[model samples]
Target: MDVKYQVFISSTYNDLKEERQEVIKVVLQMGHIPVSMEFFSAADEDQWSLIKGLLDECDYYVVIIGGIYGSIEEKSGKSYTQLEYEYAVEKGIPVIGILNRDVNRLSAEKRERKKVNQEKLAGFSELVKRKMCQFWSTPSDLASNVATSLHKLMNKNPRLGWTRVLPKEHPIEEIVQTVNVDIPKPKNVVSNGILTERDIRKVLKKGLFDFGSFIDIYFIIEGLYSHSNTETKLPNSQLEWIRKNEIPAHLQQVKEIWTRSYRCIYTFINIRDLAQKRGVPQDVISIGNIFISYIYYVLTEVWGDVPYFNNKPELEMAPKGSSNVKEIRTLSLANLQSVLHDSTLSTQHVDLAVGVAVRWELQAKNYSKAKEYIDKLINRDRYKLAPVHEIFSTDVESIGYFDTDQEGSQFHNPVFRVLCKKGRFVHYLRYTEVLLMATEIYFHLSDHQKALYYINLVRIRNNQPQLKETGNNFIATLLDDWKANLGMEGSYFSALKRNGYAEKVLGIPAFKSVLPIPAQEIALNPNMQQNEGY
Candidate 1:
């Protein structure tokens, strides 16, 4: 399988543009994705969220601590370079630091001008040395060190990433074509209404999906849950979706309100039963939980009520009389626990399974269990609590993508492009949320000290001082941190949707927290009804 990793590059952009380009080249050559601030704007609050998210998704973090102190965030008075390092270490990501050998011999333009920034830069470089790091005087030398360092750390860390689904396949090709596209709105989405694909057949899309089909389930799941949409619905357009103090009503596709939705959920009971009967490997059987876990969570995220404990393939109407997400979550936990017991899966795979359960606990406001699962998610040896940058020469695919094909511009997200093209497996979980969940769990539990302990780790990682107060203000900060780190990763959208903030943010009243059943479904089935507002 062709597996690629995303690396975040953090440093001053203008000065080290050449060095950044070289680094990006090496990462691409090695079949990894390089994410840098070049794809973002320092002034945009929305882009900062993406910056955090990219850092969160990356497998390895590399720090190029050159002479320059880099750009600073006004609120914190700390350079992003320093803050990036803080986040990478705080997150427990493997850190590989490369220094610009013999600092004094460097050209004056590349070095820091302000005395305070120079001092800060010196301290940051020293901090990188506290771990396994290297020194390089030139961009080429830096590339060599970076390649070797990342190579070693990958063998050591081995994150849950995509592999080739087919045997002896060529690397996934990046087709950069200039083509105009009008992103289509999802059809059949009514205001504040849930749109579920009628049955597992809707999920299979007129294809066969028996439990005994072990060899091809992963491909089927990946095809169904692609991050890219058939309709080209934008994912995390930082400019429009995540702005502060401003609701972006225009960017939203008027699908649910003016149109309708066509989506689906499958029964976990059948998948489990079939896998067991087929005598599939525990790993394969367990992966089914990931698919089902996602389906359960997405339904809960939109509707807060869904059918649970159903052995039947079709769930036409939601169960009546108190079938909240809590019950659905309990069933999910039981199913995932059996999957977690097997030793064949990777830690990332196991953590991925548990993280969804924690998300459910948070959604249900079950703080204690969220805290417990979070403890299991964070590993001192396996995860990191900081940010690292794999810098790029330009923002080509990372950001600043307003250019349309009419003007002959092409855009691509390296990660998504690769995963959809040649990658194997369906990985829906983001492990960084474990720490963020801990902070929220502790905050809700009124364990201020513990809450600050977790929140401060991320705060201090961003080169900001700890919060002086550990009250609602601290919790507010924690939520912002959560939104920033989680961004558009489905978690944030779901969180906002679950809490009825989507109506507020999207500037639509009928945009209810729960989606309404389609009018057609109501006609076909007498038991079906609509959401309250819709």
Candidate 2:
């Protein structure tokens, strides 16, 4: 497949506007996406989050330092340009730093006047020099140098750039048949006439199966989960959704089915009442509660403060009022706990409930509760760590693999390699994650020996040298291991945030920590409140 990389163009706006334009044009000529801060206002306190997210998505970062210090972020006391560069560096995005060969030759309008800014500019220039550096005297020189540097970078380290998936070849008759076929109405929707236990089972199976079929769910979750890893932070925008072309359509498909699935669950509740009247077992109703709790957790985590349908599934079409994220998570955990305790709960659901409980507790920062679920997962003998060699196997299920479709192509996790279309076996939970969580829990409780013991399990399993008990900076060592193991799997960034390394490691402001509710969501729902940060 032909790949088109996203190349971020970073520079002091006013001074290097011409240079940036040249670089953007070059990137376009190279058939790559050129991202910049043109659409964002640097004065905005939360712009860093958006900028950081943009950089995260970009395959290459091009930093052009002219004379100006650029717009400084008040919180970090660093220019947004510098912040962007540092974040890209922190995330290990390949950078092409171009500096003005002689800033003294620049016109008065292009040079920094403040002594402090000049000092900062000099320091920043030196910092960029530590990486891939190219000197330029003019916009054209900058463009030429950028083109050369980008070519070298592309040749040296190939990134998983974006590519359009073309339609597969089919027989002429197949094409004709497809063209003649009428579009089918959605399946798995709970109809208005589901009055029996059989009907409930049919709808539940069909609806949940249909809900699960949207490969888009994996994509959307991967994109949104970027917030947790140092990938994408803050609420996503219409632009972000558009930039990721597949997102909007899949998102719509998911929402449509997701809403229908909710309607089905509500339909199930009514059937439960009928079943109660008939003296039939309410096992399905209990099972439905497990799914509902999971649904609430997913919605709240992905989009904070979503419209929750509690007692009224009929209001599915009505405008949804926003529900508090904390409340939803708390309720999901409580419901999961209640469901897990039921005598009729099956072995399969017990596993599912424990997994959900672990995630919810982790989100809640209730490490103790998270540890309990994790312990149950460990002791149940339902899963075991794969041998070190099999951990990266595309077909292996021993270590971790959710939704392992035979048709689905797999790639190494981006953390270990370059970003690509088939980035890793997109997994939700892993045996290593469980071990790491145990490590974190023990570390939290000040049990150094236990923490080391748990963390070493992962390292030893992977055939890597283990961290010694005598090693200094155990937390740092553990953090490095956690990041390496889970990078790009949708958990590293959240891990950083949860472990208090986000502000320090991510270098983001405090307010940016909480994702801003996407503006489009608020616009669509007048009742939705924006998060604290813009």
Candidate 2's C-alpha lDDT?
A: 0.62
Question: In candidate 2, what are the lDDT values of residues 327-432, reduced to their tens digit?
Answer: 7887777767777877776766676777777767777788787878878876766666667555555424323233335423222223223331233354455677
TM-score, every prediction:
0.43, 0.52
lDDT on C-alpha atoms for all candidate structures: 0.54, 0.62
Best by lDDT: 2
Error of 2 at 60 (Å): 33
Candidate 2's TM-score reads 0.52
- Lowest-sum lDDT 10-residue window in model 1: 170-179
Candidate 2 residue 459 Cα shift, in angstroms, is: 1.0
lDDT digits (tens) for residues 1-534 of candidate 1: 446576777767777888888887787667665666663445445556556666676677887878888777888887777777888889888788888888788899878888998898888888889987988889899889888988988888888643322112111111001112222122322223332222211222111122112112222222222211232432454323322222211112211211111112232344344445546456655766755665576656555564443443233334233256778788877878876797976666677677777777787788887777778866535556434231122221111111222322122334233322222211234434566667777777888787777777767666778876685466446656655554433455454543445555445455344444432232222343444654
